[model samples]
Target: MRVPHDDGPPPPPRPPKGRKRPGERAAEAGASDMSQEPGRAALSPTVAGGEAGESLSLRPQSLAEYVGQAALKRKLEVFVRAARGRDEPLDHTLLHGPPGLGKTTMAHILAHELGVRLHLTSGPAIEHKGVLAGHLTALGPRDVLFIDEIHRLAPTVEESLYSAMEDGRIDLPVGEGTRARTIGFELAPFTLIGATTRTALLSGPLRDRFQIIEAIEFYGDDELAAIVCRTASILGVPVSGAAALEIGRRSRGTPRIANRLIRRVRDFAQVRGARSIELADATAALLELGIDSEGLDMLDRRLLTMIVENFRGGPVGVEALGASLGEPRDTLESVVEPFLLQRGFLLRTSRGRVATMKAARHLGLELPPGWQGALDL
Candidate 1:
């Protein structure tokens, strides 16, 4: 099965020609960027309209706003200061870790700290080497190229980046069919900020080219609580510390998840005419949405079920498991499957996906009766 394209989901509805959609008003959560392209607009992160939601200006406006990543934050501060002091672009940096842990946040933050212009693009958007070369040649000195999901880059496009990164040059092909002249275009010194959730899948040659690689880990419950409360304050949602903590604990350690839950709770609060979101209100809201207390969503549980029942306490191929669930195989492969595999909750075997013994017992299902002879129950 092929990796999914950014075409992972359907595009959000565009405004009716020139008319705005209902429920989007000034100061509303969805009104983050009124001037954004009509096809995709998200007030909060997560893909709202096929494209990754959240705009450049919508990224946290300042480092104080970036929150968490204390150690990385300190190191990056020094790095940015040194580069800015010398008036040079920052080193080509890589941000890696689970999704929504602020990899993109750091990319934007770095650009903001350097006080330089930032140009945004992504790995998948550059389908061919020429298209990428076009963007590279356009970069100005001290500019930042922010590429999200860097691991998804096409191999040729990835190769093209090497010369540009190493020597501030983009080699372009002038003609086709073997008589092509290669022209080296000089690019102004620029910073390449790459963000990826699947760093392990990145090739050694690609990974080795980065000067600084920082992995963003899951925020602690307290950090998430602070993020939820801070975000609510920004959106003008009246939330208490308890309310904030409740939402944060169930957020699966992702700020994107915390911000999303806050929006949902705000809607509930407004509909019920409640004063604000409380612990109980937040719990009831999340339960209604099928996000369990432990942050397991419907798909999370379904993954366990498929491994336990269909795979028969043994390994099974990913494509077959994806087919069983009727999920887009690419979505399963890229977004959903990684977290499960990382938590030791699921095992990837040479044959396929296997349910860890811990996973089987957590779901309260009986182990296969016949498997007792082959392995301990």
Candidate 2:
């Protein structure tokens, strides 16, 4: 991206009819700017139009407003302060972790603190070299370009970012045949903020370009309780500490899920004409939504039951599991599997997914006949 210059004079008037102008023809060919498509516009950290019906009003807009991730916050604070002290853009940063843990919120807070306009896009939004070149060329000095789900970026598009990150330039091939040549254009010094749910899918070369790679951790129950109270206060939905604690315990250690549950429970409370959410209300609301005391929803229980009964708790491939559940493999891997694996209810073996004995006991189901010989049963 070219930085606008203050010393530049205004362009001359358009030429007379039938007399072609030198810059007019070039401007016609290259003046079109990038479009703000729906996907790109929805990438903002604000919860408005976010996945799972989360409200942007509930999202924390600053570092102080953000909850949990103390260690990562401290590291980022020092890093941001140092960069601001030098009056320079922050270096490329990569945030990796499970979804709904405040990675997007942190990126927004960083740009806000630096007093720069943030450009939001995702890996799937940018396609081909021309589209990427347009975005990079539009950046101003010290601007922030946030790319969510960066692991999904096409390999060719990811490679195009290499030069932009390392050298502040992009080499574009112009013309064809004998006239074809690579043109290197300098970009304004800018920051690239990448967020990903799965870091393993990112290439080593792309991962190494980032100066700071931070992993966001799941929030503890107490932290989630505080988040619940904070969100309730913001949304004007009264909630008692006891009720908040109960909701937090079943939130799967995710703020997004906690906030979502709060909305549902609040609706129940309002319908009942109660002043505030109580323990019973929280339980009833979550149960109605299929979330249990252990935070295992119906799908989770179904997964466990299927493995125990049909597969005999033996190893089974994810494809077969998804086929049985009628869900896409990616959905199960990214959303359901993580929490199940974290809680040790499910194990991934070389062969496939194996149901653990703990899972059976949690569901109050007896082991199948002759199940004792099953691996890890």
Candidate that would win on TM-score: 2
What TM-score, computed on C-alpha atoms, does each candidate reach? 0.78, 0.83
Off by over 4 Å in 2: 1-54, 369-377
Total clashes, candidate 1? 2
lDDT of each: 0.78, 0.85
RMSD values, in order shown: 9.1, 13.0
Worst 10 residues of 1 by lDDT: 49-58
Tens digit per residue, CA lDDT, model 1, 184-218: 88899999999987877798998999999988887
Q: Candidate 2, residues 143-230: lDDT per residue as tens digits? A: 9999999999999999989999999999899999999999998999999999999899999999999999999988888999999999
